[model samples]
Target: MPDTRSGDRQMAPPRPRPKRSDAEDNRARIIDIARTAFAAAPDATLQSIAKAAGVGQGTMYRHFPSREALLLAVYRTDVEALVEVAPSLLDAHEPLDALRLWFGRLAAYGRIKHGASQAMEAATRADLKSQYYPPVVAALDQLLTACKDAGHLRPGADADEVLLLVSFLWRAESGPDWQERTDRMLGIVVDGLRTAPRA
Candidate 1:
C-alpha cells in the first residue's frame, strides 16, 4: 500500500491560457487601422488596410479571414459603441427628447455603416447579413420598450419597422435640401407614433 494513492492519479497536461488583453488590443488596432483607411477611402482593400495599419497582409488575414469578416468586425464595433452609450441617454431631460437624440445618433450610424456595407459588397463577399444585427436589434428593442412603457410611443408600433424606416430614410443622398427634408420626415414619423392609439 506504500505510495499507492499517489500512483493512482496521472498528472494532467498544462492548459493554454488565453491572452485576453493582448488579443483585445491587437483587435482594437486592426479595427482602428481599418476605420482610418475607410474614412480616407471607403473602398480601401485588404492590402491598403494592411499597409495603413502597419501590419502584414498575413496578419490582417489572420485577424479577418475575408473582406466580409472585416466588414462585420467594423460594423460590430460601431454597434457596440452605440449600445454601450445608450444607458446615459435614459437620463435625458425628457423621455421623448432622449428618443429623438438617440434616433439622430442611430441615423448617423446608419450612414456610416451603409458606406462600409457597400465596400464589403464590392469586396465580392456573398453574405449580406450583418454579424452584429441581433445584438443591436435587441438593444434597440430595449429602448423601444422603455418609450412604450412610458406611454411616449405607440403601444403596438414595431421597433423593427421603425428602425427600417429610419435606415431607409438615412440613405437619402446628401445635399443642401437633404437635412431639412430628413428632419421633416422624422418629425412626421414622431408625430404619427405619438398620436397613435396607446393600446
Candidate 2:
C-alpha cells in the first residue's frame, strides 16, 4: 500500500564530484620531493630521491619520463609559483613595499630553482625566461607605477631597469655567503629605488 503519488515525489540522489586521479597526485609528490632533494644537493642521486619521495622507480619514471624532464618541470613550477603570488603581494602591502617584497621573494625563488635551472641549454633557458619574464614584469610594472603615483618613488621610475638589476639575483643563490650578500645587495637596490624622502 504505497501512496500512488510517491513515485512522482521521489528524487534522485546528487552525483558525487569526480576524484583526482592517483597518477596526478603521485606525480606532484615526486616533483615536490625531487625539488627538496635537488635543492639540498644538486647532484643528489635519483635512487635516493625516489626513495625519499616514497615512489617506486617505475612510478617516478612514469611521472617524470626523464631526469631532464623532471628538472624542467620543477623550474616551470617555481616560476609559476612566483608569478601566481604577484597580485596577493600587491594587495597585502603598500605599493613600494609590495614591489620590494616581491623582489625579495624573487631572490629566494632564484635560489630554489637555480640548481636545476642552470642545467638547461642556453637557447632553451633563454626561451623559458622570455616566456616567463613578461608576466612577472607586468606585475612589477604595475607596482612601480603605483609607487610613483603614490609619491613613494620618483616620477618616471623604470621597472624594467630595476628588474634588470635583479637579473643577477640568480647568481646570489650560489655560495655559502649568499644569504648575507643577497640581503645587503637587495637592500641597497631597494633604497636606491626609493624617492627622496619617500615623497
Candidate 3:
C-alpha cells in the first residue's frame, strides 16, 4: 500500500520568465539604429534612420511614438557613450588631463547634437522630462571631483558653472577652429579653477 507522507509534495513546474513586450524590444532596436545614424552623420533624417534600422516608417513610429521621442533617445545614447568612457579616461590619464579630456568629449558631443537641441528642448518642457541632462551632469561631477582631488581645479568651482561655460562655448563656436578655441577656453577655465588663497 502506497501511503502519502504529510511532507510529500509534487513540485510545480518552474515558472517561465516573463517575455519582454514587442514594443519594448522594437523601441530598443530603433534607438540602436538611430544612434548609428546619428554617429555616422549627425543630420540623419527619420527616413534614413528607418532604412538603416531595417524597419518601415510605421514600425519606427510604433516604437518611438514620435520623432521627438526618437531624438531624445539618440541624444541620451550619445551622452551615455561619452559617460561610459569616463572611468577609462581617469585610469589612462592624469587626474587633471582626464577632466580636460571629458570636457573635450562634451564639446564634441554638443557639436554632434547641434540641431537636435530644439527638439530636445521642446521635449524637455513636455511631460517626458527624459532629456539625459542628469547623466551628463553626473559625469561632469565625477571629472570635477577628480580634478579637485588632484589640486588642479579651484576649490570652489561649481560643476554647473563649468558645464554652462562649456555649453556656451559649444554654441558660439561651430567651425573647425572650434577645437582650438575649446582648448584655449578649457585652459582658461582650468586656470580659474586653480587653488588660489584669498587675497
Candidate 4:
C-alpha cells in the first residue's frame, strides 16, 4: 500500500516567473521607440533605438535580442491591437460602422508594415505574413459577417475578397497625401460592399 501510494503521487510542474515591472516597462519603451525609429529610417541601429528609449544597450538586448526580433515585436503588437479592437468596435457601433472603423486601423497598420517590411528579409516578411494574415482575415470576417447579418452589407460579401480589394493600402505610395488618398479609396470600397435598398 505504501509503495502504491508513493508511485501514484507526482510532482507539480514549476510555474514560470512573471516579468518584473521594470523589465516590462523597459521592454515596452524599447518597442515604442523602435517603431518610430524604424518607420523614420528602416536601417536604424539597435543602439540608437536603445538610446532614444532611454534604456541601456544591455536592457534592449535582453528584451529583443536582435534587430529582427524588435521589428517583429513591433509589427506583432500592431497586429494584435488591430485584431483586438474589432470586437469592441462592433459592440460600440453598428456593424457597418464597426467595419469602417476597423479599416481605419488596418490602414494605420499598413503604414507600419510598409516601413517595417523594408528592414525585413524576404523570408522574414513571408513568415510574418503567414503568421499574421489569418488572424487579420478572421477579424475582418467577424466584422463582415456581423454586417451581413444586420443587412447593412451585401449577403455575398466575402472577407477574403474584401481584403484583396483593399490591398492597395500597402501598395500605394506613402506621400504627403497618402492618408487622404487611402481614406478616399477605402470609402469607395465600403460603399461598394453596402447593401442596395429595395425599390
**Residue 172 miss distance in model 4 (angstroms):** 1.3
* Model 3, span 57-124: residue lDDT tens: 89887667766678877776677888788889999999888887887887777765664555566655
Q: For residues 1-199, could you state the per-residue lDDT of candidate 4 as single tens digits?
A: 4555766878679999999999999998888888888777888899999989999889988998888888888988988999899999999999989999999989887877777677866316456677878988999999999999998899888988999999888777678998899999998899888897433
- Cα error of candidate 2 at position 16, Å: 15
Clashing pairs in 2: none
Residue 188 C-alpha lDDT in model 2:
79
Report, for every candidate in turn, its global Cα lDDT versus the true structure.
Answer: 0.70, 0.76, 0.73, 0.86
Put the candidates in TM-score order, highest first: 4, 2, 1, 3
Measured by TM-score, the strongest candidate is 4
Deviation from native of the Cα of residue 116 in model 4, angstroms: 1.7
Writing each residue's lDDT as its tens digit, candidate 1 over 51-170 gives 777788777888899766786677668778877655677765466766677777676666566556567567655443455566667666777777888888878767777777677653
The per-residue C-alpha lDDT of model 4 at residue 145 equals 96
Question: What tens digits encode model 2's per-residue C-alpha lDDT throughout 1-199?
Answer: 6566866666779899775698788878877887877776776666787898888899888777767677777778877887887788788998877887888888877776676554555214347778888987887788888788888887766868888888788654588988788888888787777787423
Better by lDDT, candidate 2 or 1: 2
Best by lDDT: 4
Superposed model 1: Cα runs more than 4 Å off: 1-8, 54-58, 80-88, 91-94, 122-135, 174-188, 195-199
Pairs with steric clashes in candidate 1: none
